[model samples]
Target: MSVSSVDDRQRAARLLLRHPLIRSTDEERYRLVRRYSSDLEEWFEINTGWAMHADSEVVRLEREPATVADPTHPFATRRGGAVLSRRRYVLLMLGLSVLERSDSQVALGRLAEQVIAAGTAPEFAAAGFSFDLSTREERSDLVAAVQLLLEWGVLVRVAGDEQDFVHKTGDALYDVSRRVLSQLLVTRRGPSTISAQTLDDRMVAMRDRGAAPTTELRNLRLRHTLTRRLIDDPVLYFADLDDEESAYLRSQRAALCRRITEFTGLVAEIRREGIAMVDLDDDLSDVRMPEKGTEGHVTLLVAEFLARSGVAEHFVASLVAHVRSIAPDFAKYWRASALEADAAADLVATSLGRLSALRLITRTGDIVRVLPALARFALAEPTILGGRKP
Candidate 1:
């Protein structure tokens, strides 16, 4: 048979297979056979070696199930299967490095230098950055990577010509949301649990207390203050702090300001910007006023006065006379007269404890230092300002 005839027969066979009934009246059977004659002929030619009966062949084809492609199979169209390439990983690391070093602008040459210093191979750094190249292909990859980071809102490139492109001020620095590089640097890790003796043994030979040590107590005190300052400043950069204590300092972040004026302004600014204050007293009217004769109330009142005055040590007689004059009701309530020596001593001890608990004053061997928070509070409160609480 001709190739075209064979193709027509195959098409007829498909149509015949789609039909239901096989047996019928002689006339009906004749019509059906005539209609599917090309189909039967095609089936016969294709299955010639099988020598199967027409009914059996029809049953076999009908019983067979259709083959289907699996839905779960890995296809090129599926998402989340693409792995990050090595070059992309390196670029990400470089971007992080740039963020760690600078907040404002970072030049391509400088970034390349940092990457090289960070132990990336020289060739990779050289290929990644160009000081002179202005062509699209040469610069496209780096620019694209930076643009991707900018789109992610983790970086921003300053507006300029291609050759003059630099990271924007405060753009190179990012709040690294994840601890991706914690293990990469030793300083990024937490404080070691090693004992002082072990640390000394590892660093230098054992020395007597009389021996001149590398770290003196005064130096340690200075280091502690400096480290504390870094932790307390939100805008402080890691580069601004000493590397040896950076991790420790980074861990101990308190409320950003130590001074009352700074704290109040910051709080007021936050409130003005519609930021809700956390852990604040909601009802100003509900503030408990100190009562007379109550040891706790009298102690708090005395401490508040001394803290307000910014005086550490007051003469016992002077403090008693002052308290008696200011809080005459409290003096009248006192079972022991304000002039009594025992009453004066009791007042002082109670006041000291109350003030220390409030962190208003620090007592070291009878000397007290006023905390800045308390000093600010004194300035704000009417009672401390020599006026009655409204």
Candidate 2:
């Protein structure tokens, strides 16, 4: 490829990585994606097993997580960025099911009624799920789901506002984009074909059943799985890989990392313990460290403390105390509540949450273990002129 071609391809891949679904409404990005559709499609498929589809209207990358059990990244509201709760997730799925059977346009009240019916089904009730939409809270949950759909281009407001419906003062209407709805699921097998009784079994069955029973196929699956983690995750730790995966990655690490760097423009930060596809632009990740604001300040401070303290593990209470001890110096720049002794726990929890999500640390109950990646945040001692220590 020409240098310009390489740059364009990298830009297109970064765009898709940041926003998996791009409609023509995003004019420039959509056009760029379409320009290199064939190359990008082949790259994603070969590297990550992710399917890419594009038409005149939209470009969609069907992505599946390397690890389904990861709970660090949740779907948050586009408006306030509140993480979707279990109730909201259930309502979201229920609303989508209703929309799947509805007309191109749907009304807020009608959607809520259908969702209520779906929630009250015997199977749902047996599963301990219930939502009648009789209360404003329930209605708000439905609105949250609708807002997410709207954000995703699955729904476009045509007539009314969602807040009015939440207040019971009026209703809203939306134009459902069936194309976007159909593109949302990224499973390897048709969900209907998976007859596994439990959700976990069903998930495993859906992913594994379609694979071929051959050595080449197995190796290909391993390569795709590892590449997906390298691209999507903050860090791909060697400790997390199985015996086969570890052996394969050990032999193929350089070629695998080179392919990723060439395609995505990410520099591979190779450590003794793992590999991190570091985005120089720092925009590819959903979570960021050394960020701004009071929360960010506390997180950076806690990270430095963890890295410099030389202790691998610390109790949650100890971290809370550390936060409280430092609050006096930073109190003026932080929120009023950040200085409260009791608020230290919340601060500690928030800081640890960000760190853990970034793979810098791990928390098990009250214990937090600082991982190897966090050492990057450690500060070296400053020296004065003529080699004099500060």
Candidate 3:
């Protein structure tokens, strides 16, 4: 490839990785992808086993969304965290349903009324969900879900503000980007069509039915799935892989890494326990480790503790204890009121959640196994008195 061609491919890769869904409103990035649409699509399909879709209204990359959640990711809003609480998640689904029924221009109050009616209906009430607009918490939650949609480009703000609704002061207006709304759900079946009652079952049933049934096709999908994981995650542990996946990945790992490197400029960092696509440029990932704050300090502390000799696994209770013991010294500097607790267990939970999300550690129930990547975080060598290399 020519120099410019290589740069364009990398730019396309970075754009899609940075913002997976590029709406028309994302003017600069959207235009960048538009100019390189063919190249981006070709690169994405050949390298990551995914598709890059582009049109006048939007540009999107189709890939399996990550299940991990971090409460402090920068892409998310100042108020919103990386992880959505269960209540907020339910509200999000409710908001989507409402959006589907809304016209091109959506009025905030109208949407709230419809959601309240549906949520308070006998069937929904029987299911244990209640929507009372009078309650500040309920209002805030629905607004949070709507704000999330706004951030995702599914709904564009044309008028009023969501903060008004949250404060019980006023309502907002929005324009529904139907093109973007349609692309929000990556599932094959609508929620109404699914027979599953629980979220997990429904999620499983929502997989694209177009997937071929043949064994050869299934094998192809397995390869695609594994490749996508490498491109998307910091690491892929063998313990997390299925038997067939492990076998396929073991045999075709080098080929997969080469294919990805050619397309996205990502280098493979392979180890015995897992494989990670190391983007030395740091342009691909949405989250980072060893951040700067109390959370970062706590993570470093935990990583150091785990990386130390004789430490194999960490328990939630033990981690909580550690955080509680040391929280006082850092509580004054902590930015989040949520983390400024007397015990700071929640802060510990958030840190561990982030660590797990980064793939530096694996969590099963209460126990966390520090992965190989974290070994590199060992405390820097002590500096000598003369500022000489130690």
Candidate 4:
């Protein structure tokens, strides 16, 4: 292939890995995805076991995780950026189901009623879900779920504002995109076919469809799992893998990392503890570090402290106190609200959330263990030999 073709293919692959969905509304990206659809499909299928579908209207990449155990990355509402709680997730699913049977154009109030009906069904009630939208908080949760769908392009706002509906002043209208809606579920098998009694079992069954007994199949599974984790996760820790997976990774690390790097333009940072596919442009990740904002500043400071402390673990409450003690130094740079005594908890939580998401730390209950990756953030002590501080 020519140099330009190689660059274009890498760009297209990176776009799909980052966004995963490009609608016709995103004309340029959708066209790029369509142009390289065949190459992208073969590459992803063979390397990551991910399936990509590109059509005139939309391009969707169906991604299945190697494991469903991680909870660091949660679906957050765009409004306040709060992670979706269990209740909100349930509401989101209910709303999606309602939209599946909805007309092309759906009114906010009509959809709300349908979601409420489905949410409050005897089956759902048995699971302790109750929704009448009688309270403002409940209405806000519904709006958050709808807003998530709107962000995903599954619903297009037609005329009204969702906040007006939240306040009970007016309702909104939306044009549903069934094509995009159908692409929401990415499991290998339909969930209804699982017949598993527990959620964990069902999840396993859904992802583990077409399992066969063979050494080759086992090796293929191991390769796909390792590749998927390395590409999708911020860091792939050796400790997180089983013996077989760890062994396979040890034997094929160079080849696997090279293929991923060539395709996505990511540089692999391999350490003894784990490996991280470092994105040079920093555009591939949803969670960014050292960002510009109060939360970002606090997270950076907290990371520096943890990195320098050299302690393997610390209680979260102790970190809250540490933040409180250092709040005065950052009061001028940080938001006024973050300086309050009560704000230390939130600051600490946000900082730890970012650090944890980056795989620099792992939290077990109240204790946070600093990972080896966090050591890079440590700073050297100032030397008096320097004439003056810059």
Candidate 5:
């Protein structure tokens, strides 16, 4: 397709939502983006309230409160995942700090040396953090951090193995992707000047550094926040929008919906109550209904039951009972969570959580107020009509 084609815009929009679309990994996308980089940047910023970081080898969109965690995926496995513990997070940041001062092509030995040197400094002593390369476990943790960097496109392996470094057999060399490294610092200002004693305080100080947002800034924030919710979230209800947001949505819903559909190929199914962008692709979202396994069966069954029952609200106890009652039917194939002591409760929670995530049900405490979107999922059992015999 040509650079300025509708197809290009659609692909770009998908990539923007699914970033860090690295040039190293996806050179075709990278080059296409680079060709029409200016337009894509403007479109993303104007429509979604996200900043696009484009350069020679990468096009990354910075989404704040940078949520990268996937409950379904393990911590170490997520290429763009968030660090689990404060200790590991500190190491990640420290490693990044160490990489900042190094050459374009940095050696593993040099990087670790810098990290260890920085850790033992009098300043970072509060964390009581130290990395001893002599210890295998510590070395492995460091390697984990480096591996994460590789996934991030911040570092590309030149000619060495992290396992070698972990085993103390040999050092490794990595060609730092400078474009990726440049966008790594999330904040405009470093935390050196912040007079905050604790991490929370430091974060707050950093957040509050800029001038109070003007009306334009406030509007941008609102648009971006709401757009993110609509895209990432399963539902957007009119009742959920604030006074100002409600007003904005009312005025700009058409324009907003049109742009979203045009760019992302999602059809906006609007109603008096709320709006949802129906993904025809069906593969963009992590959670899927009519899925397999114990969780999937329970979700579909409970959803069907809830839709058929037409209850405005339900207790967890009721769902639990339903799950226990039906366990025997599916228990033969799905043995994992079928017969556990807390099977009923766990199944109920999982099913309800999935339903809630999909915007089919709203859970207030133990009560779930089934929403209108659920009417779509009401399935009719097959009827045995003997037409040929007749």
Candidate 6:
């Protein structure tokens, strides 16, 4: 059978084993090696450690180590296994909101204002009192919060002299990093308290319905909600975030965006088309593969072009031309194939069939359209790369 015809379950298992964590687990590693020994050699490099164990003895484990990290590397840390305190998690959520809402050069005072608005203002107003946090202790709390944010790299202090300090304006606004917020907001809630049997039942139910796994969807939703929340909330200011924390938060946000996009693309493909083997094509060979899972990417590209062109489809060609001129990075991703250019008139006809299957996007002929849900993914928040509603 062709590589494209490989069983998806087998493929997924192979993919799972590619992870360092999974490979470290003797049972899972051996099971994969046993069932697909030939495929395994092509897909992975087995270590001497794995060579010593018999394949049959490996399948008894209830859990497997994560595959994303290198087990043999001394410095390689396990992914998604670290425990975070509730307080830190709360701060992370708040920080994400701040990053999402504020733009570069946001004032510290503004962040304090938002925090007070969200947490304290209503109580004070109801008591018929003019509440002011001008005291040292109150100011310290604000400082502490901002410092935390800064340390996370979500916010940066504006530079100035000593006079900038004495003015005590506390106006030290921060430049919010949307990427940082996006990452923090997507922090996962651990496995449910549900029993293992119940979980297995749910997985079985999903399989019966020919549905993509529910666990995958749940994780996607969690990330999506976080991204949406960040875009909707007020930004955390520099004074609220310290240097170290600010950097950390920024890295997280970047990672989140990259993962979200990848996951979105992968899930959309799976939902629209059943599992199929993916052989990364580097030679640009002309292969007759089934159309699936590419609609969202295409729609996004077209919609972005249309939106920038004032929502008129008539100017699509001109818009495409303009994108080529002004946004080369975007152009590289959206460029049509040589065959597409050769069959210009037929391109739309060919693409429509594939675009329709994903359901995440809508298209009328060549005029790309996006559904409300898909549109949310494309929304641009000044704070986030693609904005979402709260």
Better of 5 and 6 by TM-score: 5
Q: Which parts of model 1 are misplaced by more than 4 Å?
A: 1-293, 312-321, 324-329, 332-341, 379-390
Candidate 5 lDDT over 17-102, as tens digits, reads 66645664687777766766787788767866667787656677765431233232223436433445555566778889888888
Measured against the true structure, the TM-scores of the candidates, in listed sequence, are: 0.25, 0.95, 0.85, 0.93, 0.75, 0.25
Better structure of 1 and 6 per lDDT: 1
For model 1, residues 1-390, the per-residue Cα lDDT tens digits are 676655454344333333322322224443544555545644433322111123311211221111112111111111332333445455555656665655355555455456445635565566674232244443433454454444333443443433333332222322331222222222211233333444444232212123335655534433444422322221233443465545443443333223211222222122111111221322211112243455656666666677678665655556555555655566556665654645665667666655554434556664666654354346444454567768
How well does candidate 2 score on lDDT at residue 94? Answer: 90
Task: Note each model's CA RMSD in angstroms.
Answer: 37.0, 2.1, 3.7, 2.2, 4.7, 25.1
Q: Worst 10-residue stretch by lDDT in candidate 3?
A: 66-75
Better of 4 and 6 by lDDT: 4
Best by lDDT: 2
lDDT against the true structure, per candidate, is 0.41, 0.89, 0.75, 0.88, 0.75, 0.38
Clashing pairs in 2: none
Let me know the TM-score candidate 4 reaches against the reference structure: 0.93
Number of clashing pairs, model 5? 0
Which digits, one per residue and each the tens of the lDDT, describe model 6 over residues 1-390?
Answer: 554434533453334333322222345544554565544333222210121111322221111211212112122112322233333333344545555666677766666566555545454456453323566545554555566566545666665322232246535756665444333321122223323355456443332323336765544433433332222111122233446434443545555434323322221111121111222431111222232233334444544544444342343354344433443354454444522433333333333333333232344444555332233234464665566767
TM-score of 1: 0.25
Question: For model 4, how does the per-residue alpha-carbon lDDT over 168-230 read when each residue is reduced to its tens digit?
Answer: 999999999999999889997888787888889988888875765899888887888899988
Model 1 vs truth, CA RMSD: 37.0
The local lDDT score (0 to 100) that residue 233 gets in candidate 3 is 77
**Candidate 6 ranges beyond 4 A from true positions:** 1-95, 121-132, 160-170, 188-390
Which of the numbered candidates is closest to the native, going by highest TM-score? 2
In model 5, what are the clashing residue pairs, if there are any?
A: none
lDDT, candidate 3, 84-137, per-residue tens: 666677778778888888888888889888887767667777777777788888
